[model samples]
Target: MRIALGVEYDGSEYCGWQSQPSGGSVQDALEAALSKIACSDVRVTTAGRTDTGVHASYQVLHFDTQAQRPMNAWVRGVNALLPDSIAALWALQTTDDFHARYCASERCYLYLLLNHPVRPGLYHGKIGWFHQALDVERMRVAAQMLLGEHDFSAFRAAECQAKSPVRNLTRLEITRQGDIIAFELRANGFLHHMVRNIVGCLIYVGKGKYPPEWMRKLLEGRKRSDAAPTFSAAGLYLAGITYDPKWKLPHFVEPPLAALLPRMSRPGQSGCNMKIR
Candidate 1:
């Protein structure tokens, strides 16, 4: 049977989501625990491969297993052997056609920025920090240029293996509450470091280093060098993934950061729980 799981992780201690020969990856830890549970070698696939230090609140993945244990076994059992940084949130038997990556329709991400003179102490490694004051209104205006279908080559990483640079960015919402700023984006797909690169450029605009229209120019330029440097991975989170309605996957719950901030009155400015298109 095919089993799908909702996984969450603090990606600080391990490598990225993908397994490597060096062996400190969320995938390696999960597969090791799962192999013990299934009594056989098991391979799994994920909806997205996050970079090192990138967190995920609701990462989705699937594996083919013949072991007929109860669903709780997959959840609690696998989690038991996994490290404290990784967890299996839910498990469900899925159709053979349901793939974790190929079947995904949309992906959502959140980037948190702690905009204060003092560096973050309590939330270190969990948020990006900027000492300069940022204008949220300018950042929001700059971010609007990224919405809809476009060639995002300017924001893609050099090592990106995706066949195409064109992606449909359905949403890009920016909001701020006191010293905390949040950026939420939903897209049909993302290039390597795309969100981080966009955030870097937005930060430039927010700090008055560039005009909001500079974002449009950078998008049109289609040159990676024209955009700002890639932002830190510490603040990025794989918020959720959307599959076809037929799959009926559980929705992602809002993380506590949302409740701590006042709600923005903008159209797409809902809390951290992103709306899937």
Candidate 2:
């Protein structure tokens, strides 16, 4: 049986998603837990591989298991054996051909920047705090220029091994709430560190080092050196992913209309449950 698992993790202590010789990885810990649960070796393929210190709110992975255990057992068993930093939220039986990575239609990432003289106590490890002041409005306008299909060679990592630099970016949003600046991007695909590099360029625009109009010129240039330095990995998070409805697991039915209905209440009223599925 093939099963899809929803995951959340704090990447602070691990090396990265892929296993490495020097240190532990998210994949290593997960596979170890799975092996213990199933009493057999189990391997997993993830929707995306994140770098060291990069977080994920809704990452997905899939694995093939023997027909002995229930899907819920796979979830609970793995969670029990896994460390507190990583979690297996849920597991649903999937089709034999379902692939967590290749089946994804789009991926979204959010890069957080805390631009203030001092950082917040609660978000110390989760965010990048910069002492320099940033102009959010200018960053927003600059990011819009990156909203369509383009050759993103300039914004990709030098070590990126993607076949092509062309990608369709559906959304690139820059917004600020108090001193927290966020860059949200959605794309059909992303090259290695593509979003972080793009955030670097937008940061330059916010810092008055790069004009907003310069983004268009840089995109056309296609030179890797034209973009700003890549931003830190600590601030990046794999926010979510979209898959074709047909690829959704069999037992996991979409929520019913009654459950999907939204409530109308005053702004401060408390009974609200917004579920995205």
User: Highest TM-score, which number?
Assistant: 1
| Candidate 1 ranges beyond 4 A from true positions | 253-277
State, as a TM-score between 0 and 1, how close model 2 is to the true structure: 0.88
Per-prediction TM-score: 0.92, 0.88
What TM-score does candidate 1 get on C-alpha atoms? Answer: 0.92
lDDT of candidate 2 at residue 44, scale 0 to 100 = 94
- For candidate 2, the 10 contiguous residues with the lowest summed lDDT are 252-261
Q: Quote the positional error of residue 179 for candidate 1 in Å.
A: 0.9
Q: Estimate, for each residue in 1-277, the C-alpha lDDT of model 1 and write its tens digit.
A: 9999999898888789999998999999999999999999999999999999999888999999899899999999999999998989999999999999999999999898878777866667888888998999999999999899999999999999999999999999987755668899999999999999999999999999999999999889999998899999988889889888899888775443453223322233333342332
Q: Model 2, stretches more than 4 Å misplaced?
A: 249-277
